[model samples]
Target: MIKTLIIDEETVNVLSYASIKPLWFTDYQIPLSLEQRIKRVQISDKLFLISEKTTSESKLLVIKVNSNGIFSELDNKDKSIAFDRVITIALSQFGESISPGKGWGRYVSGKKLSIYATKRTQKNKNRLYFDTSPIDTNHIFAYALDSNNNGFENIEVDESLFLDSVTLIDEAINSSWQNTVEADDKTQYGIELTEDLYRSFGECLNFEQWYENKLTNEQRSFVDKSYDEPVRLKGAAGTGKTLALAVKILKDAYRFETEKKQKRLLFVTHSFVTAQLVEDMLNSMDSEMNWKFLEHVKIKIVSLYDLAQELLNYNLKKFTPISKDGKEGRKLQFEILEEVLTKKLLEAKFKVGVLGKCGDNFKSAMESKESRKPLLLEILNEFACVLDAENIVMGSDNGDKYLTSSRENWQMHLPTEHERRAVLELHMGFRKYLKDLNVLSMDQMIADLNRYLMSHEWNHICEDEGYDGVFVDELHCFTRPERMVFHELFRLNKSFETKKLPLFMAYDIKQSVDDNFICTVKKGSGSALINSTNVGKTNLVELTQVFRYTPEIAKFLSDLDGSFPALDLASEWSELTLKTNTPSGAIPKLSLYSDPVDLIDNVFKLASRQARSLSGKKTVAILCSNFDLFEEYLIAGRIKKYYEPISSRDDVTKLGRLKGKCIFSMPEYVAGLQFDMVYLINLDKVEVDEDNPSCGAYRRFVSRVYLGASRAKEELHISACESRQGYSPILQPALSSNSLLMS
Candidate 1:
């Protein structure tokens, strides 16, 4: 009773491995067997093949079983088992490879064959079942036989049964910050604004409408709507956690304190730039009523890192900062809880290098600032030689060697060594801050980062000297190794801080790039925080009613996203790409040269055409990573080039949003929002040829490539530097894809 099942398009002519072999039996060993019977297999509880998949449309399943009634008597008390388990399978001969069915349908489904599904026996009854997955469609077909048995020579099976794969990934094109979601629709659970407060917030909302005609995307509405006790916001990347927290701060700012005679609530956050931005936006609003909190101004701001930094810097009267490491040290030592953190950063010149050709895809995972593999690869060939060097790598056990010798070299243990410890400590601090604020887990991490930032540590330092609470912004960067120091801060039962503990913090937790959790005073209580919200999922909220973009662009970008891989999209959700509605205009352009010169030339031509006008006030943006490349395009003047360098922090503030005329060659972090014109470079990574002389650095530039391409408004024309086409398609789904938008 061997079972076998196959599924494909209902309308298509499904062909078997026709004319290969008839039904017969033989022992395992493929060289002797015919050409068609060999298929891929996996063994487990009740072996199954990862053969079938489901798209947005339909699902396909393939199964296999023995002809000796091996599956017929199975006692499947569990409802999870499917009916296909009892069918018999027929086998044929397969050559070295099997042909896969092709179409523009969803994806590449698993092709499965045999599996080692052991039998389960019940009292006085023979039973059989496929013990592998009955859910999550990557796998199809189940079996209890070792695929190599070759017992059957004459069997018939379809060659193209299952096909297609769908995964979640980022397919977004980055845009300026001002590109906002409209406020036409309120959030799923928006908090009510009181009479006076409502008047003020409504006034600000009106101002936002007048200024940008849009609202921020709907943040997960837990803390945003309800203010009770102990709520926390947390999530990775563009999940809108920070936006939620920001909204919470504004809504809550004047709500309390004024109702009772309590002190005004303060905002704690990460940096002055962020604070300045928030304050600026808040000031731009017009209030409808005579709101005491807004009029009296109870809300203040601060940074936790600045407080600690000041402690070390002044030492009551301290001074310093010459080098980057030296500058990084003051913050690292405090976050690491080390009185003096001493470890010289490996010198840029003497650094050891290994794994010369692995490329940048590997670098994204590195936790360290420096990488030696690139440096190592440079020295191998005289032309590729970065410098003369002796390279050696050791195996994990230290009992082995790779190419050269030096058991457990620095290159081997470098990336995660320092930063992991440091960041973990800060992570714990964030948890403690949330607990103290009574905002334990309701909100996501990104929201937690924002709430932490709007703490009163920065703007309201004077108020906090004698104040009862502590709040800080940019907690991740300021509070290195968050899990460690914050754990102690979270201690309850015993009074660790009779006066106060400096636990307030805010950060872009999504961008922290790690999954560090807050240590709990109570274990189960901590567990609750882990899955408080659907952290990794997109479409967690209803954004359709909130969407502000043109309907077509919104739909196009989101639709294009389904084509990209899941991993890439998971890394970046903030940026979404949509070509602009602005008609073609000649604005001066800059050749941001992350790509090669030819790409610069071509895009330069395209941009110059749009940037230049007869008036000659042509201001175009030629964005580049480094300053030297910016000049190269400026000097070439290929397409009416306008070169505006962002050398200072102040210049960064006005780069994209600057009025009158200007060209912007901005960095990745500062590219979004405020920019009227933006042209990104290298949307996708092009494969490099081994024969090419420049294949050397191609591996090192992956991250810069991802960060660089995301900065654009409207038109996204990727200029492929190399001849290679096709990049891992990045996902940027249309907002309308979610029925919530339509609703």
Candidate 2:
């Protein structure tokens, strides 16, 4: 009788030369690759005769025979057999070189074999062959066979070796294989194989199954808690803030169904891409709660911009917000501002003294054609963050309000009433241009919707159609007026008149990359929302442990956080920390290439190799810092097969359907999503002058790098071409702390 320890479809081919047959085999249902399956039996005990039959020839085999049965069947007269010859013959079947040495020790595949002697025999006289290869712990102590010919025929079955070998092989197989066994099955050997897979690879790739049983105590508490007032959940990147919010939505749908209550819930994200991601998250949580129940609950997941468009369409017959034209609305707004400045304001008697009063070389910046864009952007930021955000209309009572109001956050650029009046004039010109076109900007659309929501007609409509609860993801991206709209959208539930509306918001101030949106949530301000007087009191919940990326990534991000003093001041609303609950992984690789083409080629080759080795079981992202590099990689035919460019909302919406291809995107486009591995290319393109590290450009550049680096859940590869000025000054902190490996 023979026992099969492990066998695959290729087992028979490997065993054909030895003329061995396996009687029975057990299907463990582990999804191991063919190579792994072959390696498993190649390093197994000789007695474990493992073989499988398929439609084609088998490729792997591991044989384990019953020692007593084999010995008894041998002729009694020829009691002594050459055990070394048998071991050599069995190993030769694998088609690898084997060197002979004293005792049982030999070299196979450049790995030395260790000799283990049975207690009954002398240590060096009678030995068993065990390969102690550094290939991995799985292959350690794999082979076992007697060496001494003196007592080879009298070799008794070593029960201890037999049990230990089986246990080691079982552990190895479980680690390499996917846990495909049914949860209800009682005969399964291992239940934590999926978790092991997540730790080895990354949980982001297997998100549907990753968090079902892996939620930390803090995450679970957030999901299961009932809110009296509006709740604000704040955490650094990878802290599971979005995951907790999704689970709460699922649980709420379940509770509504159980109570036989009809409820309307709203989930708001920053953009169409993030909205699609939220929908995918909800669909993936079907195991936690039946998704069909959500039909009765009437949950709406939409981006704030889209929601504003829908509301405007409902109120006015033919209203359309200006299309951003693939530049995230920034390019279009810049064109309008340029038209207002160069064509309208500059042509008119524009107060040149106002530019001089703005300080920090504002006049020189406006005079130079090359430096004019940043100047225009600063003026535009004032309009968006102060004017539109506060609903201050030019030539109205709010004009006086803007001049007298505390511009503490805006004092750097707008030092006095002169600059404020100039910005208001530009705002008036921008509005006139938009009014002539009959199309509103995204901010204008949101402002109109906010006014509509505050109307008596909207109050009457809300009584019957308003949402019972509202959830906001990435709340830091929303401006003051946008935040106010969330409070107005939810109706006062009759059962909880004393409590605030059930508005839940999750945000991390460090991840806010938009220059137009300024964070106003102060430390110990007793409010998490900016200008919270409009939204009322809210409760803050901080998630301290990061469950997405490894400790190495966490430390790298923490070092980055400490390097930026401006980031600390901006994030004073919460004490940001990056403590991780994940295992330690490879330090992020920061490689500098002399040639730009070589950097791109090397990064893609590394990604391709990783994709092949993982068998497309993991997701990879290559985030380019600028559009030029992004487009360059998109057209490069050599690496096109390995990745798909996520440049538009349609591409982002199809992310869940993408298979066997890495995601190629800019850092800003892939916000609120994560990957198994991330490669940030062209950090040298991110212009940040060390002399003015406190500049807004430096802050925006740091935010972009942080966003891209935080996307990696397990591994991060950051590469750049060495410019004439050397590496980007932004990497100094990571380099000084030795948090990044120079590959």
Candidate 3:
């Protein structure tokens, strides 16, 4: 696609060629000795240039003229002096990282063009004609390669960056930290902090700096060292919440294992696969914040579910929960899993218990939620006698308080037992994990009791210690039942004055709104009550700057058909520059022509490709909003050549496995966690389901449209029938109109 014109013995004559665009890049150079500097010269009244070895390659001088003239016409004397010139190049050296029209654009120059100044400014209205207009360069040169020209030496054609920009970034971080660390201060960048934690803001810079992208003070600030209590984080698709969580996990683990050796921190998520991913991320570079010196730390990573399941599975396989299995006085074990579901455990027990439960066909009691409770209770009654009530009931106190704003209906309900029960289990499980991890005893749970009442027993529970803190992520995703459980524990802590209480809880509540999560309770349920002094005021931190999207992409996200709520929040820094006039196309395409039959063909092909990751490698899931849609995609004609779509796996390992690559296909119920990278496909359909109003059967069917989209890292490849434009509210920072095609 590119051609070069050589000037062996040039007598330049080309002038005024293209009418629409008056000029093009033309270069003139002279070969000079390594020791030679540049002999400066002035051409006309506007141009001055010289040859120097400063920018990597030593070359001839450059001249930009406003009038009609070529290099060979440069008077007999100047032309003759260039006889030693070896080569000349007209190049677009990956020059433009900045899009001038996209909000306050600034040109970041390199050392080669270090002395030049780009367009000082463009009046706001001038951009109106920007699409069909020529660039307003202010007749000044803008960018360069490097201070010494060797800057982008190894940069790929597609991945070039300005090295000097990193220095500017380092400066910004050093300048802002003293003023930016707080939950209530307003910054020059307009970012608001939600917590009062400060780390060297500059210290958080990532590889993006060379690409002219870096996290803002707010985004940087949000990546806290630790959370005092369970927290929620919300952000658009591009936001760095996940990255922050990854970092938080690392720091917490490092502190617990190194500084507070006795304590442990738990990174809990919904699925075993996600837990595995959390493990992978914890091991990623992002988590190694202070790497060069992070020695003497020991830690283990596992999902809350996996850990519990492993313990239970250990008991199931090696021993029995009933007395028949025990020796030293039948240590009948039971787990009140700090988990949302016991899928793996149930699956394992189901097969074991189904071996003729009675006469004809009795499924394992453990396999059925319905049958397990009765059987377990029978076992528990005989082994572990009931001495206490399970789970906490946390809410509020004083008079006239209600979960809802209006106490008109005392009998009105906010959450049924189904929701409350899940909340309770998770909360109790969290505390239990903390207790075990810290090696704390029942007495230790209340050792620092200043006012909170977290103690169930007042005796030494552990002869050792536990994790420094507990990290309860995605709190927004939890049901109200879970929160009720949290209330009891914290209320107890408050009453007993447990100095061991969490320093704080980190949450991004913004996502909660989309999850359809609301704080609610029965009338006079203590939900409306608060600290007497802090009663009217609820303390919160807000992040105003969004560092994820480029300025251009950020604007498109804000303006895209009004589907995305871009403007509602502002960005401290822009990562993209809008290069297109209007976003009309740009969908990663998986074209299905002809009738609906074409789509059906691709569907099956999609499923076949997914059946490969079920092995010990990792869990992989294929997702679609509906089962029929899943079938349609699995049966697609073209893609069907590669896949064999089906719901049940005869043996998860039959499909074979991949190294470093894992993917699985399943219904929404199966799509609960994350993977190293995720590719969402055939997602064109969007129709409302009448049943399951609690958003239980909404677009996500399993994941809320809001939740499913959040489950990926670094890459999000969606194959949809809709154009990128049609994918309005669903995807933020709309893909550029100049999109890349995907089959």
- Of candidate 1, the 10-residue stretch with the lowest lDDT total is 95-104
Candidate number of the best TM-score: 2
Q: Using TM-score, rank the candidates from best to worst.
A: 2, 1, 3
Highest lDDT scorer: 2
Q: What is the per-residue lDDT of model 2 for residues 293-387, given as tens digits with 9 covering 90 to 100? A: 35568777777766775566521233345542122555468778877777643543564555555555655665566567656877766665567
Reference-based lDDT, residue 699, model 2: 74
| Candidate 3 error regions (>4 Å) | 1-216, 223-232, 252-262, 286-302, 306-467, 484-500, 503-596, 602-623, 631-656, 659-686, 689-743
1 against 2, candidate with superior lDDT = 2
Q: How much does candidate 2 score in TM-score?
A: 0.64
Q: Which ten residues in a row have the lowest lDDT in candidate 3?
A: 125-134
Error of 1 at 179 (Å): 38
The candidate with the higher TM-score, 1 or 2, is: 2
Model 3: per-residue Cα lDDT over 1-743, one tens digit each: 10111110111101101011111123222212211322222222322222221222211122222232222223333322112111111111111100111111212222111211112233211100000101321111122221122322332211011122211222322231111122223312221111101111223333233113444454445554334433334444445554565565565555555664544444544333333334434433443324322444434344332232232332123221111101101111224331313533444332343222332212344346643533332222211111111212224231112222332232212233322332233333434553453322121121222112234342222112223344444444333332222333222234324333342223333333222122222233332212111112232333434443233333433333222222112331122222222223223333423333444445434434453443323323344444455655555556544433323211121122222223334432222234323445544434333343233223233233333333432233445554322222233324444232334
RMSD of 1: 34.1
